[model samples]
Target: MTTPLNCIIVDDEAGAHLVLDHYLKSFSSLTLSASFYNAIEAMEYIHSHPVDLIFLDINMPGVSGMDMLEAMPDPPLVVLTTAYSEYALQSYRYQVVDYLVKPIDLPRFTAAIHKVFRRYRPLTPAQQEGNTAAPPPSSLMLKVDGEVIRVQLDSIMHIQSWGNYVKVYTEQQVYLSPVTTTEIEQKLDKLGFKRIHKSYIISLQHIQKITHGEVHLNSGVILPVGNTYRRDLMEYFR
Candidate 1:
């Protein structure tokens, strides 16, 4: 049998805790290790325990989720939780496994967890050394309106979520489709699209300038840089 993914929840809200608890119980592959109301308590728990994953909340009273991530000596795979869509782009810079908006539903939540398992599961020594056989390529075709648009993996710039739909921004134009941000994020994640804010995903190549808390695209679109994402972006610069 596959090992159950050890997980924890770190959020200040009581509702969030109860909701996450309910969702976690529904997943057979997941095992809850602990839950904390603040980052400090979570940090203490993690220091003395082993965890495979973390469901982290972005906005907190003190020592925000982003700050806690930055201070970790060795961080586990992270899935950011936030109500605001603006923090989506920033979370990608930290190499977070996924991002989930407020009031997360079961279907969306399960998909995010699956993505983490697909990407980070341990590989054998041979596989790690690239001696094992390669996996098949994963591709996604986007349909904009009635036109079938084949977006080659190399051409996508980023994806943004607006209400119930997602706007996939590319070098040429944007493709609006009826999909959740989390759903689109999983599809484009393997191709290098990083969630940098709650509503924006950026192509790392199209980034012209990153200053203050904004990412200036070559197309002149300025995207906000979240406080949590700033450090990771700086590391990429180095």
Candidate 2:
């Protein structure tokens, strides 16, 4: 069997530790080495032991997570955990692998672990021998609910403007991202997506039929095609 990755959790909340303990069992490749309630103890332990990954909480009583990161000259791979999305952009300064919002679900937790493995996992000889032919899937990074998450482009079925936020519809979940529809339209227009109305954008690959100023998606979602956009949208069919 391949060696397991030694990971540690540094969070003051007892609930957080419990949640992690439950999730870690599902990943046999990861082993929890230690759990510290504060950054100081966690830092001292890291100085003396070999740690592969850290699930660090940003807010603490005295020493914050950022302070601990500043003290380490060469820290191991880190995944920042926080309850606020405002710190999302700031966390990127430390080059963390992923920023997970509090009350993290199993799918999100699993996604973060997979990202860690992608960054540190060793490649087999077969992989090293030019076996790479397929390109990586295109994805979009969006800030949602105080966390920056990656959503695969192809998985997106449609987007609907909701006040200051936009609801991103996918096969599994709908993400309410704090991004303007205009901003998202600019980013997705050239990538197999088109703005069908003032409030909606549909994925070209998901379109099943278009009739009478309405675009029908394969997922059974029907969105009205705005008068201003209908002529431009019909260009694709012609």
Candidate 3:
């Protein structure tokens, strides 16, 4: 029995909800736990109930989706939906799983759900008493097929974005995980991993050389630093 992800739709627009609801039905691993036309109603429900994911809109009636998200002391995994592409960078700053523009397509929405499902989840009741679901890693988790296995933070050398999937290069092995670069960036940003390119995120500690807009890792791998990210990368290195 696979654990289903409990998710809720928090968009005021009925049409948005309708589209999302239809797309969500295709995944057996997801459960539409609830739906709210306003943030206030969603707020009340979230306080008492634990949900794994949220499909939030940028603009809502009064409180606004961003407002509620900012107010929440600890918000759930969020996938921001909006009609504006200009807010994409700002949305990622909020550590959202993915930001989807309005009139969400099935392929993109499915990718977002895969991000949430591939994310590390809490232990089952059986695991609390030691049923051997595998002990938690010091910092990172790797998704292998349907299971999310554990990996230490230091073992990660670099990560490459492969369309809807990411390849995690660790000290011992390279793992192919079903998640996006943005999702991996959010997960590893604070852990000393930095996104040097749109397609590459590298471990700062593993850098053997960083010059000519390229980073060489101790593992004998070289990754290109994106022009848009070079300034930030330089700032981090300094």
Candidate 4:
């Protein structure tokens, strides 16, 4: 079995720690090594400890979270948390794994962690030595409500935007994931998925019928085609 990812949280606010703690508890793949109310203290702790990830807050006292990252010559993966949107551009310069706004929801929190997991998945010794017997992945694992759900690619018929979350529709049931339509759109695009509207993405393989302004899936799901996407669909048919 692979080792669990160890991570630390550095934030000045107690409430911030509470929120992160609550979310991290649900992840079986991760374990919280330690948490610090000050970034400086956390920096010192990391020097003598092995941490795979870091959850940091931007607006701290001395030795701000960003400053802490600068101090490390090779900082582990980091995810920035703040109430403001202005630091997003600069956070990229720090090479953070993801950024979360304050009062983080379960879905978005899970998504951010999943991003880190996907990017830094540990390769076994055999795989590291150029093993090629394993087949490519045909499904995705989405963490929903503290449990990881494995979703098959071809089983997805469409996705609908539900407020701040998305409802993924397959033949079995609708699985909700915390993300924007465009986020999932990018993931499924290369896998025979196409954006049909601003709020919907449909799997091309599941589409059974199409009209000028709408498309019907084999599951009897009809979705309206957005004006912006109409031209693309026409060209695709041509």
Q: Output the lDDT of residue 167, model 1.
A: 84
When superposed on Cα atoms, how far off is each prediction in RMSD?
Answer: 16.4, 15.1, 16.6, 15.8
Instruction: Give residue 96's lDDT in candidate 1 (0 to 100).
Output: 92
The stretch of ten residues in a row with the least summed lDDT in candidate 3 is: 134-143
Put down candidate 1 lDDT per residue, 159-195, tens digits, no spaces: 7788998887777777897768877777666465677
lDDT of 4 at 145: 53
Q: Candidates' TM-scores?
A: 0.51, 0.51, 0.52, 0.52
Per-residue alpha-carbon lDDT of candidate 4 for residues 132-233, written as tens digits (9 for 90 to 100) = 554444775543553345689989899999887889999999998776787677666667788889899998889998986999999998999999898997
TM-score of 1: 0.51
Model 4, C-alpha of 176: deviation from truth (Å) = 54
lDDT of each: 0.78, 0.87, 0.82, 0.82
Model 2 clash number: 1
Query: How do the residues 1-238 of candidate 2 rate in per-residue lDDT, one tens digit apiece?
Result: 2888899999999999999889999999999999999887687578568799999999987778887787675688999988888888988888899999999999999999999998885558788677566443387766665444668899999999999999999988999987799988877857899998999999999999999989999999999999999999999879
Tens digit per residue, CA lDDT, model 3, 19-97: 9999989989888999999876686577558798899998876667877776665678999998888888877767889
Better of 2 and 3 by TM-score: 3
